[model samples]
Target chain A: MNKNASRFLAGPYIIWMIGFTVIPLIMIILYCLTDGDGAFTLANVAAIATPEHRKALFLSLGLSLVSTLICLVMAYPLALILRKRNVGQGSFIVFIFILPMWMNFLLRTMAWQTLLEKNGVINGILSALHLPNLAIINTPWAIILGMVYNFLPFMVLPIYNVLIKIDDDVINAAQDLGASTAQTITKILIPLSLPGIISGINMVFVPALTTFVISNLLGGSKILLIGNVIEQEFTKGSNWHLGSGLSLVLMFFILVSMALMAKYDKEGEGTAF
Target chain B: MEHPLIDLVNISKTFDNTMVLDDLCLSVKENTFVTLLGPSGCGKTTPLRIIGGFEKPDTGKVIFDGQDITNLPPNKRQLNTVFQKYALFTHMTIAENIAFGLKIKNKPKAYIDDKIKYALKLVNLDGFENRSVASLSGGQQQRIAIARAIVNEPRVLLLDEPLGALDLKLRQDMQYELIRLKNELGITFIYVTHDQEEALTMSDTIVVMNQGYIQQMGSPEQIYNEPENAFVADFIGESNIVPGTMIRDELVEIFGARFACVDKGFGVNRPVDVVIRPEDIDLVEPEKGTLTGVCTHLIFKGVHYEMEVTTPDGFEWLVHSTDMCPVGKQVGIHVDPFDIQIMNKPESEDEEAVGVNE
Candidate 1:
């Protein structure tokens, strides 16, 4: 058989992408370009300039940025530890991180609500010990926590995968050349694993930026992210044009993030560590 | 009077349940190229790692320049390694890789730049400072690895089969390059390799090892000519290690023929192992020789003809000679008495056949 024959195997996925991704994307663009009467108007796209929409957009950006940073700060060291332990390819630690991802994402966020609620599992235990009762629920901090909880594996797997692939001999070479452990990590490990790091940032940041589900469950009704606003625009307000317009604005940020990823990771080799 | 530059005193290492180095002791002189030569799993690389501080021996002290440094980490040790795969930092440029040690020490930028240039120049990679390590060929990477280590101006250099990855031609060229680098650096080198030819060509002393024990350690010539046992003789070069008996002082026997030999000290009829190089045997008329044999096989080997001669008793000898003897032809096997090397029987083998030479 010709080796190119294997390319035919991707036929189903290509068709799926066209139907689910391409058509929906075209519809979104058309909706964003029109008003409710299907007449052309720039007002829906310009709605993002309003004070309420601007606050939601910046809030989404800042919160997600913080969440992505927390996930990175937490994941890189964990990945480094796993790599030092020679963990790769079906290690229990990797499986543990990936297990929560297999559970329903909304269910996992709701479970976190129970854990972080004022009179829930965590606070009940704290109060029994006469400690401070947990009250960060229905706040930006809770949403950030939920975002990190849901998306941490995305950051861990790639960084761990990349770190493990680095030859142990290279690390030994660094130490042999008079580099301390910290210097070796900074000079060799981080630079060598940059592809995975960028891929990880893209993975966690993009999803965290566009998520309305976590904020809805954890932030209650007070905080409004761009995603929550966009969700409300379509569902409760029955305004698909304004919703699609806001989604396009959100996509511009996603595209920029993706471009940043593509510039550093040309191989598209980032899926996991 | 000079003390040894590095002394590994009774070093022992074990991995899992197997002993990798069995109470090994080695002393390396300053400015000398010493090689740890053995087959894979014979614990050659382990000692080099121990010396480089990449491995800690389970027992014994690693004394360097009169200081016990068994507990020192690799970065604190005054030595560097040229790893087998040339472990250049893949992320760094050649100059950055070479300057890694200096940068860690917080050296002045000008001093670092000058050292990088000097190191690169020494490795003949002077203009390759900006080239990434991944861009270099295997040989170039090997040079960069050497340059990276030497840029630190370490007193000792540990090389763990650094040329094992290169092709034959490149490996040979790098052998000369390494010898030149070693002399130019004036550093004590603890080199590890299994290639006896490479060890012979470059090392001032060759330490032959087997089964995690030193079989013999000496000069290249001494190792080849005066192997302590059958294993060393067989490992260092091709040999016909047959069972024999030391008949008396300066006399021995093989294949029912008594030949005048130079070895003694074995009691009469004591079983021994006899070593004879293929080149030592000469072919002549059957009647005018000590023993007669028929040429069984012959093949021309570029520089000489390698032919197999079989005796009447089915004893086989691998002979390399300029004179090609045709198959099935009757020939005389002539060996000069001085060419005979007698060794003690290996401990593991049972004392059985003892052929006589007259």
Candidate 2:
């Protein structure tokens, strides 16, 4: 009976995946080749290469790169410290990081808005302390900070898992062989833990490039990223063809980056202690 | 004539209120191969770690070359340890593993190459420079571990059951190779193993330990022939220990029969334990020897047959011989007087009286 049920279960999933995901992807490709008036042409694809669309592409790429870099710089040390020190405290810190993620993304963005506004808690505190009130809500820094806060756990967990499994004996062996603390970390620990960092970068960067909620709340409708452009094309302008083409382009970049990361992961095997 | 290279004086260690090493003192002369022989939990590995500077003794001094090094970390000590697991860096190539120490010392590139080559050659692992450690077999990986430790020319080398992971035949082969390498390098080696045969075959001095205390320390022959206590005799090899009474200077009575032995100075008559090795007992025709027994069990070992005989007084004695003794046959057991080791039984009233008079 179980085998019969499993056989029945397998057929629908194949059909459902083909109907929902595969069919829509095929339709997106077809639409990407169509024009604004619905004729088959490359005109819509060429329109994505326009100056305004190019600016959105550059902004998404730059922001995602900065966000990924900041997350790595912050998370790698946190992961190492968590792997080596008090684990209960580490889990509590991880909980704090993930609790922000569990809260509604819109809610988190709104919270940040309340904190960064001119009369918000941040400016109120600054004024109370007789410090200068700074404009932070409508800037790239606010978007990058929000991205880092939201995506840090994605960078940390992978690196932490890898660091925790590294044999303590290997570190001792290096030290016993007269390698100092710094050399051991550089030559042994970092090379061994690189795969985790690559996975982390891929995790943080790809999603960050397509995230629009934080930008909408923090950048005050001033910053225009590719995701924002895609949303505007799809919903406000009613141009699904252009949005699908831009989505495919973002996907291509993500695929290329993931391929490069896979290559690095393969090369890093058996090189760390 | 020269000072001992390593001296551990009255070293003691406690972990969580349990004593691991209790006032352990040992001194290794230059270039000597010493083995710390013991069962598990005997503090053998702890002493090696202490000497290697991986661990610190709570109350002792580790004097190397007449300088105190008890507080030094593992890197500062002039010793390297080959762990039982062959703790090779899985990420490094064979060459990198061997050159790690040389690189740490900032040696010249050519010098590092030469030392790595020489150390690899000594371990019979030449031309494995480019191979990843994960690709090597267990024996090959062990050799790489040896190469890595020895490349830096440490003053003393510590091996903590380094061949323990190998199969029996490979373990025996590596034992010979380890002895050959030790002789070639002339490095002071402190080896830890529970295998008595390996200890006997490889050690210039064997220190037998049990329950965190050194039971006996001597050459292999001395340890096997003249064990200091029942524990040493039992641990080093198989022995049939029987309760006896010391009847005279060289005579012990066991199970209502007088047996001649060589141990003396306990008293005219005192309770003692007599130990006799199975190989030392000879079997003769029944009713034509000093003692008679019926062979109850015969086990065929490859090189020798081991027989258990029950004497007329119901005491069991083990005998080993190349010729098989058939079960259920009456056999006469003859042991030389000197083959018996009689130890004074602990603190009975008779022993106390004897001690008081002495």
Reference-based TM-score of each model:
0.96, 0.90
Q: Chain B alone, TM-score of each model? A: 0.95, 0.94
Write one digit per residue (lDDT tens) for candidate 2, span B1-358.
Answer: 9799999999999989988898999989999999999888778999998888778899999999999999887888888989888888877899988988888889999999998889888988888899998899999999999999988888899999998999999899999999998999899999999999999999999999866677789999999999877778778888888888999899888887788888889798788878899999999987766788999999999899989999988888988899888999998888899998987564555323222111
* Local accuracy of candidate 1 as per-residue lDDT tens digits, A1-273: 576776688788989999999999999999999998999988888999999999999999999999999999999999999988886668788788889989999899999989998889999999999998888999999999999999999998888888887888999999998889998888899988888999999999999999999999999999999999999999999899999999999999999999999888776656554
Model 1 lDDT tens row, B1-358? 6789999999999999998988999999899999999888789999998988888999999999999999999999999999999988877788888888999989999999999999888888779989987789999999999998988889999999999999999999999998998888788888999999999999999999877788899999989987778778888878777778788977888878877888879779888888888988888999987889999999999999999999887899989999889999999988888888888876553211111111
Instruction: Please state the error at residue B78 of candidate 1 in Å.
Output: 0.5
Give each model's clash number: 12, 1
Query: How far in Å is the alpha carbon of B199 misplaced in model 1?
Result: 0.4
Candidate 1 residues lying further than 4 Å off, grouped into runs, are A1-9, B348-358
Q: Please state the interface RMSD for every predicted structure, separated by commas.
A: 0.7, 1.1
Collision pairs in model 2? A270-B91
Best by lDDT: 1
